[model samples]
Every structure is written in structure tokens, then in C-alpha cells.
Target: MSNLYERSLNVIPPVAARATKLGVVKGEGSYLITEDGKKVLDFASGVAVCNIGHNNKAVVEAATKQIQQLIHGGHNVVYYETYVKLAEKLVELTGGDTMVYFSNSGAEANEGAIKLAKYVSKRQGIISFKGSFHGRTLGTTSITASNSAYRKNYEGLLPSVYFAEYANCFRCPYKQKKESCSMECVEQFDDIFKRIIDPYSVAAIIMEPIQGEGGYIVPPKEFMKAIREICDKYGIYLIFDEVQTGFGRTGKMFAHENFDVKPDIMTCAKAIASGFPLSAVIGKKEIMKNWPAGAHGGTFGGNPVSCAASLATIEQLENGAIENGVESGAYLKKRLFELKEKYPIIGDVRGIGLMLAMEFVGENNVPNGRAVKNIINYSVEHGLILLNCGTYKNVLRFIAPTTVSKSEIDEALGIIEEAIVKEC
Candidate 1:
């Protein structure tokens, strides 16, 4: 029989990019069992979607049970047990002041979020950050600025979308030093409002709490707090694209919690359902209430099985995976920093919790995409799977499962170090 990768070539399109061509057969914890009988350490975690680890028994069991009970009750028509229960749990988790609108993917959730903001606030303009990846949908494509390739063929997108700078302190977009930095990332919005689009016309200001695809860039708390204040000042909906940073990936239930700031609207997916195709637009109840019925409706927005899996995923996160991520993330960061000290090509190592990254650069601190490609190739050859980020494709991101063991982490790190030494 032909391998999955080879079989895909005959039918699958090239639009969906794969970081590795491994023919994965099974997943257990932090390891992927390949069709060729290779047990590869999975640090990518399906782009941080398998937070509680792949094929988790609890999640699988819950989904299976729900599948038998009610696979698709049709959210637009009627509510099911799992669907209502999951929403209740999320509302409780978000302090009981928020309501959720279910969708099929991160892109759909973002579309709903923007629509929610525009509907409730009755505004036309949207402010997004440069080097941010919201989603692939046309409406979201308009706001995404991580790479031009994403919006290459699809120009003349949703209008009134403006881009601003994200605070990547290591490679500050404003090029300001940490010691003397004056929160220019925050002030850039004022310039945008003054010269670009009027803040009053802006419906929402969306951002990744920890810029994911633009590289795992974590901004300072002050910057997030300032953005919160700006949104409050102008009645703009503050939207946090927590699709990548949610579900214990950031050491907290949500990345925004780390900065002690909450968004008026939040788009979540990825780990929300532990690999299930589910996403949600969580918003303040006050705003969500005003979003009249028929304003948004999807046939399979909150599938019963996906909702069941999400509830189980949440239980796993609360049980211990989140705490494990906190401890393991610190351990991983320390090791990566040590690697940075040893290798000159490793320019910057930064991230929060399990969502960490190391930017590869040349002698003069110029982005070295070639080094990243080589290192990733070497890592895959050595049984360690990894992913790359940054618009320049020079950042190596680590999306190891939250439940990863110290030994598994050590093994992946050793492979990475060996790859850097031999390849870069």
C-alpha cells in the first residue's frame, strides 16, 4: 500500500501546506507513530491543537458517546445537551458575563467576531496588527498581514481594514530598545487614528494575544493594558484572536489572562475541542444579546461531538495539563536559552508557556530563513517534528503538547541542538 503522503499527491491540492511529509498513523501522548514504524516526537502538536495530547482517552470517550447520542442537532434549529452544557461551561469560565457563538473553524469564529463588533457597535473600520494571522477566509484575509502570500490572489478584500504594529520586543517593529522603550506600539494607534482611519468608525481592534504565525511574539503587559484602554476610550470592540494561544497553551486558560486584560470579543479554536473542528466567538453578553437571531446562523456550528470533546478537553486542562505546561514551558525555555548562548545563529528565544520560539539569524542579526529550513529538515530526519513561523520564515516555533514529559522534551531538545550544530 502507498503511504498517506504519496496517496495524497494523487488527489489532494497543494494549497494545504505540510511542515513534514511523515505518514502519521497513530498518536499517543507526545509521540506520533508513523506508517513506516517511526515513533517521532511531536513538538508541533498539530499547530498547538492537541493541547491535552493526541487521542486522549477522556476526549475520545466523550466524543464517541456524544456521537451515538446526537452527532448534529443543528445549532440553527435546536440546542442539544452537549452544546448547551459546553456554552454554560464557557460562560462560567469567562466569568459568567459572556455568551458564545459557535462556528466551524478559527476563520469562521473571527468572521463572526468582526460581524458581532460591526453589528453591535455599528462601525465600519477595523484595526488589525501587521504580522498577524487571523484566518484564511476572505473577510479575515483582509485583516491578516503576516504574509503577502496569504492575500496574494485575493486582493480588493473587505475594505476599511487598517494595520498597526505589534510589539515584538525582541525584534521590536518600532526598533526601540527595551531599556528606553516608550510603548511606541501603543502610540502607533493614535497615529493610525489621526492619519489612517478614524477611531470612531472602527468597530473592532483584533490581535493575537501572543502573535502566533508572525512568530511567537509575546508583548509586554503594559502594551496590552494600553490597548485595552484605547478600545475603551473609543468604544471599539477589543477582539483577541486566542485561537492559537487559548486552552492552556499560554500557561493560562486564555493568553489575555496573563496580561490581566479581557477582550470584548474573543475568537477561539485550535485546542478548544482537542483537535475537533470547532470554534467559538465569545463576547460580552451585553453585545451578544444585541446580535439578533438570523444575524448569524450555521448548520453545524456546534456539533454535539465537538462540544463533548471540548468539555473533556477543558476538564483535562483544569486537572493538570495546564500546570504541567507551566513547569515544562519554563524548563524548555531555559534549555532553548542555553542553546541560544551556544549558537550564534539562534538570535532570539522568546514565548510564553508551551508556545515558544527561537528566531534564526545571520552574523549581523539579519533573518536567516535558510538556517531555519535546514534546521527543521534536520530535526525531521532525526525523529523530532517542528514548525517554522515569522513572515520571513526564520523563526522555529515549539508547540509541544502540554502533557509532554521531561524526558520527551529532553529528547526533542537534543535533536534540535544536534540539528543546529550539524546543519546551521
Candidate 2:
């Protein structure tokens, strides 16, 4: 009998290569039960999608009920209860001054966000940060600069796009020490506008509030404030792609809340529906209103079941999972910092809430992607699942579920410690 991975090899494309080969049959809180009945600690959280944990009772029940009542009430054709309620809840969450447009994925939502900005601002140019991963769509791929491979054969993408630096204090783009650093990231945009294109031509400046795939890099609060100021000065809309940072993954309902800087347009997905395929473009009501009907429409933007699941996910986050994320995230970070003391090759440890990461580097601060790969493989073989981030692929990111317990964190850290010791 061929195993699931072996069978998958014949049918699945190589582009969909996954982190693990284990055939997961079920999920309970922070663990995944494999085909062979091995219980693996899933710290990746399906790449930070299952915020409230997989197959959560509330989410499943809500989704099940909606599935029975109404499976697909296309947003364009008509409205539904779960869909309208979820949008209402989100609007309220964003301070009741914002309106939402639904989409099926993060990339789709990003496309909507930029289009909304362009529609309202009547501009064509966009400014994005280097090392940002917006999406795989041609429009998003244009803004994404995290990996060149993503744009290999699809060059000459959306034109009028400019890239700026993001704050990665550990591997500062400007190569300046933190103590002496003066927020060059913010200043880089000034040079961008001066040397590249006029700010007035830029419709939107899209960015991941916390650079996720670009290495879990958290920009300085000052940098965020500066970006806000520039956008205000130029009348350019600020778009925060919170696809992976929203829905209480960062201890708060949204990552932007941590910085006290709200974007004119925000895109969220991933954890919004626990594990359902759903996303949204949330914009200031004034801006969203300008995006008239027939300007944008999706046949299956807001699935009823997904919206039900999202409402449940939000309820779960508010109930206790988000609080647990704060406590466990701190505990996890403290442990990683301690591990850093033992492993100098573990160059930097940084992140917010449950979205944490440790950067691996060789002597003289050279990126050590090999170490990260080895550690990940070893951990998987030893019953722990992990993932990596960063442009160099040298970052070990810990995306544990907000519902994760301290014991699970300790277990994952133990496996990681042993894997590092054995591999690195």
C-alpha cells in the first residue's frame, strides 16, 4: 500500500510542496493526529490560519449550522445573515467607521484593497516595502519583493510600483546598529519619492504591519508613525495587509492596534475563519463608499459557512484564546531568548504575541538557512511540526495556536532544543 505522500506525488504539483509528509487525519486543539496515529504538536497552526485551533467546537458547529441552512448565497446576487452579521461585527471592531468588501483569499482581498484605493484616489502608482509578500496574484506579485522567484517569468507586472525598506533591526537593511539607527526605513521612502515617482501618483502604500514571510520582521513603532505621516501628507491611502496578523493572532484583534496606527485600508484573512477560505478588504467608510457597485464584484466572495465560522472564530478570540496568546507568547519568547544564550548561531529572537521567530546565522552574522532546514526536518521526524520564514529562509517562526497551552509550548521548545543540538 502506498502512503498518502507517495500517492500524492503522482497527482500533486511540485509547487505545492508542503512542510511535512504526515497524513493528518484530525486536529484537537494544538495537536494533529497522523494517519499512523502519531500525535504531532502543530506549532505552525497551518501557517497561522487556525487561530482558535483546528475543528474548534464553536467554529465547527457554527459552520455546520450554516452549511445546513444556506451553503452559498452569492454576495453579488443577494445578502445573507451570517455574511451581513460578520461584516457588521468587523465594522464595529474597526470602530464603526469602516466598511468591508469580502473576498475568498488574502490575495483577492489585497487586490480589492488596492483597487479600492485606486478607485477612490484616482491614482495609478503604489508604494510597497521590500521583503513583503502580498500575494501570488499578478497585481500583488507586482508589490511583493520578498522572493525574486515569485516573479521569475511574470516580469513587467503592474507598473508604477516602487519598493522601500522595512525595519528588520536584527539585520537592518541600512546596516546601522539600533542604538545609532535613526529610522532610515521611513527616510528611505522620501528618497523613493524624490528619485522614483511623485507621491501624488501613488494611490496606496501596501505593507504587512509585521512583515510575515519577509522574516517575521516587526517594524519600529516610529517607522509605522512615519509611514502614516507620509501617507497623510500625500493623500495616499495606507493599506495594511493583515492577512496573517489579524483575528487575535497578535494577542490583539488586529496587529495595527499594537502600533496605535490605523490604515485607511486593511486586508485580513488566514485566521479570520479559523480554517475556512475567507478574507476581506476593510476600508474607511468614506473611501469604501467611493468604490461604487459594478466597480468590483465576486461570485463567491462571502460564503455563508465561512462567515459563520469567522463569527465563531472572533467569538473564541474574545472569550479567552487571545488572552492565552499573550501569556503563552511571552512564555515562548522568554524561553527562546534563553535558548539564544545557549546558541549564538540563533542570532535574533523577535515577534509580537504568538507570532514569534528566531533567526539563524553562522559566524560573522551570515544567514544560516541550512541550520534552519535541518532543525525543521529533525523536529518533524521527532513528532514536532515547525515552519521557516525570511527572504533568506533562515528564520524559524513559531506560529503556535492562540489556544496553545504552556505545556505544549514547553514540549515544542524541548523538541526544538534537541533538534538544534542534534542538527546545528
Residues 100-201 of candidate 2: C-alpha lDDT, one tens digit per residue: 888999999999998898888999999898899999999999999999999999988998888888888888888998889888877887788888898899
Task: List the candidate 2 regions with Cα displacement exceeding 4 Å.
Answer: none
Q: For every model shown, what is its TM-score relative to the native structure? A: 0.98, 0.99
Worst 10 residues of 2 by lDDT: 1-10
Q: What's the true lDDT of residue 100 in model 1?
A: 91
- Write the residue-wise lDDT of candidate 1 on 1-424 in tens digits: 3389888997999988788888988999998999988899999999999998999999999999988888887888886888899999999989899999998899999999999999999999999999999999999999999999999989999999999999988888778997799889988888998998888999999999999999889989999999999999999999999999999998999999999999999999999999999999999999999999889888889999999999999999999999999999999999999999999999999999999999999878999999889989999998999999999999999999999999999999998888898755
lDDT against the true structure, per candidate, is 0.93, 0.92
